[model samples]
Target: MTKIFMAMIALLYAIPAYAMDGTAFLKQVDRNLNPESYESYRKLINVEPDGRKKEYTLFTVKKGVDKVASIFLAPASEKGRSTLRLGDNMWFYIPNVGKPIRITSLQSVVGGVFNNADILQLDYAAEYTVEKVEQNGNEYLLYLKAKTKTVAYDRLKLYADGKRKLPAKIECLTEASMLIKTIYFKEVKDFGGGVVRPAVIETDSPLYKGYKSVMIFAKVKARDFRDEAFTLTFMPNLESLR
Candidate 1:
């Protein structure tokens, strides 16, 4: 009983009263995020400075480490399109082209604007090291440094809702010490058991001033996915995965 009490005390100290310890916050975030049995309806709206707007709806599913799939539907514009990221490989399906293109590690990302590595959602524990913690009013901040050059962002600053333990904002710094992008979590909802997923994610880039991409999740479903669903053989049938 004494040891348990000590552990509890250590945990309390590790988690700040107004903010979570940098490393400890990440540990909790990792624990609370379940890659398996996760699926969501994502609507991505991109607004350009030229006033041109494009929207796409994606059905996303994740089974485990390096296993993911996205099916494009809607707007009557993006039909029969899909993308699959399995392990380290990313495959792109274009109905107009009638074939799938595989992206290599050396090549750039295909979908949206973020780098492929960034979208792949690499394990946070492997990619970043927590540096410090801070508080801004009611928000708790976590400063992180990239562990390797493979990570697109050299520095990461995360702001979390103090009471909710959910991310409120993220600042990603480029290697040049310039702000690359910032993501704001507008709404967070508990889904599938006790996991908290963002209902909307708004992303803005320094390169594209006055431009932003808003992603809203319309529906979320949790299910068991097979390893084969993320393979090249199944890339053509991405729409059927759902």
Candidate 2:
């Protein structure tokens, strides 16, 4: 009887260790994607059901956990437009408006599968808590829950590569578990300074049936910036940072 009780106690102690391992791996995945503060360039392409496509280029900068900013760099119309995210607060700045306008995580700035929250995303570990983790064959499936209601997606199903510890796909869902969109990470590349991650991210949604969006990342290198660089006043001056 004492041996059986000891085995049961050992099993109980093992449970929490398993849970912590999942969360710890999640943090590692986040760091593998990008440095805490860095800059990069991305080309966003939106495709219609008819194959018509529109593209926009952006220079993005991210600072510690809750600060990120992005500015349009190509296409004359989108040039000079910028977006900033400071914690739960987000804002869009237009050249003509000359003032920052508040925005929500659910709203799309460029109109596609990716929303404002996705474009200016912070570390996943920052906005989400791992609810559970499962190992499926060669992949790790992470069940994530939003830390707060203000988050864009209520829950996320993240499937990561077991060998690389990088995300392979993510499914965004509503509170009632309705499917919103699925994001696929692809084309891994090394951008120097230990920054090796997916260079292409494609997303599609049942809600936006027949439409798709793709983001191609480039020049994703580690670099530091001042706090002012992620503020509204610096939105117009974002280009200068690059």
Candidate 3:
């Protein structure tokens, strides 16, 4: 049909070519996925091989590409716990502990496949550089390399929806390209105010063979915050922002 042919033609052109700038396209995808500054509520669930599950809800805020903070909202034990990230430096605060302690990118606040880097994630363009882009049917596959050794995943393979420019799946890898985990993004929903993207991100890792983690996003909104809100000194007051 003529309509189908036209749609195919449009997709072909939309797909990144050798002449297209990979970094620019990646940045576009990052923006399409989230605003430069925003607030969101996420329910993180961890599942075990025995079918046991644990869930925690968080109120997250981001000020820029480098600053992000989150506070746990549910489960009495983690309710007052907060985490902050200013670039590569991260800290976790517990109400009783009173002082913020440094944490690593690979450590998990909510144990499962997702680590600190994934929980307090910055913009993809902030941490990664596109090494190459390829078109796979209706999707665009992006090969990403971490700009620094401190990055959690040294390599990433991202498959994005060509039409929406949003990631459909991501494979996290080590320096040698060994697969660490696979994250699948699904259930796209519109959160309004120009925020529309996947609401569910489920992840599994071979390293944690019997474990899985999922992030369910809700009420995501585009908004700006103060840089101080992303500091260790502000971790205890993170809940006040919401």
Index of the highest-TM-score prediction? 3
lDDT tens per residue, model 2, 1-242: 99999999777544433534777888998998899999999999999999999999999999999999999988899899999999999999999999999999999989988999999989999999998887755678888999999999999999999788899999999999999999999999999999999999999999999999999999998999988888888888988998
lDDT of 1 by residue, 1-242 (tens): 99999999777655644444577677565445444557777787777778787887778777765577777787676767777776566777778877889765334333344445544454455568988777655677787898877566788888877666677788988766688889888767776666676877788887768888777775566678777877777877877866
Q: What is the C-alpha local distance difference test score of candidate 3?
A: 0.91
Which segments of model 1 are wrong by more than 4 Å? 1-21, 30-35, 50-52, 104-123, 135-138
The Cα error of candidate 1 at residue 145, in Å, is 2.8
Candidate 2 Cα errors over 4 Å, as ranges? 1-20
Q: 230, model 2: CA deviation in Å?
A: 1.4
Better of 1 and 3 by TM-score: 3
| TM-score for candidate 2 | 0.92
lDDT of each: 0.70, 0.91, 0.91
In terms of lDDT, model 1 sits at 0.70
Residue pairs in candidate 1 whose N, alpha carbon or C atoms collide under 3 angstroms: none
Ten residues in a row with the worst lDDT in model 2?
A: 11-20
How much RMSD separates candidate 2 from the native structure?
A: 5.0
Model 2 CA lDDT for position 168 = 96
Can you write out model 3's per-residue Cα lDDT over 11-126, one digit (the tens) per residue?
87656667657798789888887899999999999999999999999999987789989999999989999999989999999999999999999999988889999999998999
